[model samples]
Target: MEFDYVIVGGGSAGATLAARLSEDPGLSVCLIEAGGRGDGILVRIPAGAVAMLPGYGKINNWAFHTVPQPGLNGRRGYQPRGRALGGSSAINAMLYVRGQRQDYDGWADLGCEGWDWDSVLPWFRRAEGHEDGADAFHGGDGPLQVSHQKAPRPITRAFIAAGQELQLREREDFNTGDNEGIGLFQVTQFHDPARNGERCSAAAAYLHPVMGQRANLTVLTGARAQRILLEGRRATGVEIRRGRRVQQIRARREVILACGAFGSPQLLQLSGIGRPEDITPHGIEMRHELSGVGRNLQDHLDFILAWKTRDTDNFGIGLRGTGQLLRHLARWRRDGRSMAATPFAEGAAFFRSTPQVDRPDLQLHLVIAMVDDHARRLHLGHGYSCHVCVLRPHSRGQVSLASGDPLADPLIDPAYLSDRRDLDLLIAGARQARRLMLGAPLAPYRDRELHGMHDDMTDAEWERHIRARADTIYHPVGTCRMGVDEGAVVDPQLRVHGLQGLRVVDASVMPTLISGNTNAPTIMIAERAAAMILAAARGEDECAGHQAARAS
Candidate 1:
């Protein structure tokens, strides 16, 4: 099969890019996804995200494990990525955050022109369909849904109140590029009563609505992209595997790689477009010598402070929790407003560890359940946890080829908390969480701290505890960093340097991880990329027309 554009990975960016690019009726686009179509109820329901976490790598997730990080006492961190059409957006906690203004400005500072907050804000607004109508910062008539949970748990309210008691401002919106307050997060959920407030994943909003409807777009599921079929330095097509059949599909114009942080770099390396030293070991002839193809990996290192709770209103285990869930499910079916609509981490706060910092460098996810090790190791009871994550870390890691085989998973090493500052800030963030939890508002329901934590630990003990317990918040980026530097993989236009007819339109191009959830920002990235792609296409068409007229 042939297409004007072939997109690899039908995740958040790929889905959005296909939907936008295919809007031009004259162009043909193909999106290939390695996982199943994201149509399961577990993928749709807002609260069903919990069930998807345990059996992640098996069902709809990649569930990749990292190399034992020396920073975390030789503990291997768990990294779960959505394998379905919507990518991680399908399996993530659906908080609709777009980081701070400086995050994009920081990208501009890194030589990424036209990517500052002011320039990118329009794209962010263009991708959102906010429930609260169009405002200066939000869009009301876009494809993706951004709305509040039907009914927030009382515990979430308590968390907010506790934050207020600590003098933290209560922000009603975090999407405005100023997420420096405690508040309830607006989630990516379609709140239609008919749909029971199901999750509005990237697939649901961008791909599913237009999959078969668009004659110009082709979406292929369960198709694993093996390698980029390159002619000289130009990418001509992709070799893909489906079932036992291997086939090659041609791309007339360009191949856009939207595979997330891990998959994108892995595909690049597998296609022989990485460091010669790295590729030579796999016995594959190197096609390019880009040193930054799989380097600069950054992720938010989070620490969960779990404590047993006395209330059953929040999510938990046991007979009482089960009964509460059943009642909520029935209520959700009737009016689309219930505890079932809540994404477990209902409320959050963004604040600096100290006053000297220019912006909030840390974030908290207030989970209404005892989520330890991504909930793989469950404690037996009703409890809650405050997930403390460093918004920006100085540490970096890399993704490299595990083997020359395309079917093999890439070796992921986030090297979490390798920098001493990362650990220090996390320790500060942990202390802040304890302060908020032990505040007057949340004290009524507070039970003893779980995971053997106590208040009497010294500073040294805190550092030891953080290194022992830190894990990923699953926002990996910067593998295919976009910049003008020699180490950069892609240029500011998102075109891969030293390569033709290829581009990377995904989170992998992010020079730095955003300060919050990555789904919204990634969609924004695709929105900008789509415009650039179309603009370039238009320019080429104009040039072709001019030359044809001259020949005539």
Candidate 2:
């Protein structure tokens, strides 16, 4: 098989890029995904997504575990990545957060040219079709739907009110650059009265509507890319396996890897483009010596604080909760407004861990449910949980090859809380969440603290609790960092170092983790990457046309 562009990992970036690039009538594009089309009801219904979270076998979640972290007393952290067409956007909580403006500016400062906040803001606007309509900071005509929570429970409201009582100003928009506020997170769903609110995943927004319509675009589901086929220094095709039948698909122009933070680097290393020591052990011939293929890993280390309540509104794993959910389903079907349409982590707060930070460094996702271990472990009684995470961590880890086998999972070490600074910041955020939960506004619903904790605990006690209970908020980035240095995997244009016809267009290219949910930022990255690719192709075409005219 052959195409003009071969995109690996038909997740968020690949789906968006395929949809955009194939708009040009002359280009032929192929997108290969290792999972299904992601059309399950659990993926569509916001609340039903609990079944797909990590340890649950519902979503095509590449439920990866990290190496033992010395900081967390040798406990391995869980990092789940979506394996379907929409990628994490299909399975994630659907929060439409763009992160702080300083994040992109910081990338530009780190040598990624044309990626400053001012430059990338347009791309963010271009990808979003906010329900709030077009404004100075939002776009209404874009493909991806961004809307507010349709039906939030009373517990969610109490959480927001409690934050406000603590002097946290309630802001209507978190996507308008400065996200320091307490509010309900706007999500990637369009509430249409005809069908209830549908999860507007990138596949739903970009791929599903256009795949069959475009003859030039081909999508291969259940296909895992094994390695990149290189002709000298240029990538020529990809060797992929589909149900034990291996095939080579050649690309005439480019090969793009949108396999996320874990998959992207793993693919590169499997293709023999990582550090020699890493590749040599597996008996694979090293094609290149890019030492940064799987370095600079980053993620938000989070801790969940739970409290018990008799309120049926706070969903739990019991008979009363089942009845409540059944009632919610009926309401959802009738008016397209119910708890079923709500992403459980509906309300949120963003604030600085310390006053010295230029932007808010800590974030909170106030869930109206007792979520434990990504919903893998369930609580028996009615309760709620507030998830607190450090927005930026000083600790950096990596993704490495566990074996040469493409079917095997990668070695992911986020090294959570490896830095003392990260622990301190997370501790501060946890204290803030604790205050908000115990505040007078939430007193009406509070039966008691479900877990072991006193309000007057010392910092040492808090630190111990944090180490024992902390986990990932599911945002990971920066393994294949974009920069113009020797250690960087990709250059300013996202092209892999010392390589041609290959590029990384996912979260892996981010020089650092953003301040909030990564789905929006990942989409923005695809938008910009697609623009750059199309422009370059147009230039090449123009030059070729001129040469043909001269020859004629």
Candidate 1's residue-wise lDDT over 1-552, tens digit each?
Answer: 999999999999999999999999999999999998898988887777888876644669888888888988998888889999898888888889999999999999999998999778778778888888777788877889888877887888999999999989999998888999999989999955556488899999999989899899999999999999999999999999999999999999999999989999999998999898778899888898899999999999889888888887788787888888889888876777788888888898999988999999999999889898888887766888899999989999999998999999899999887788888888888998888988888887788787677887777988888888888888999999999999999998899999999999999999998899888999999988888888788875323432332222
- Give the TM-scores of the predictions, in the order they appear: 0.96, 0.96
**Per-residue lDDT of 359-468 in model 2, one digit per residue for the tens?**
99999998888888777777788888899998978999999999999999999988888788899888888888898889998898888785597878889999999888
Candidate 1 regions off by >4 Å? 540-552
Clashes of each: 0, 0
RMSD of each: 4.1, 4.1
Model 2 C-alpha RMSD to native: 4.1
Which window of ten consecutive residues has the lowest lDDT sum in model 2? Answer: 543-552
Worst 10 residues of 1 by lDDT: 543-552
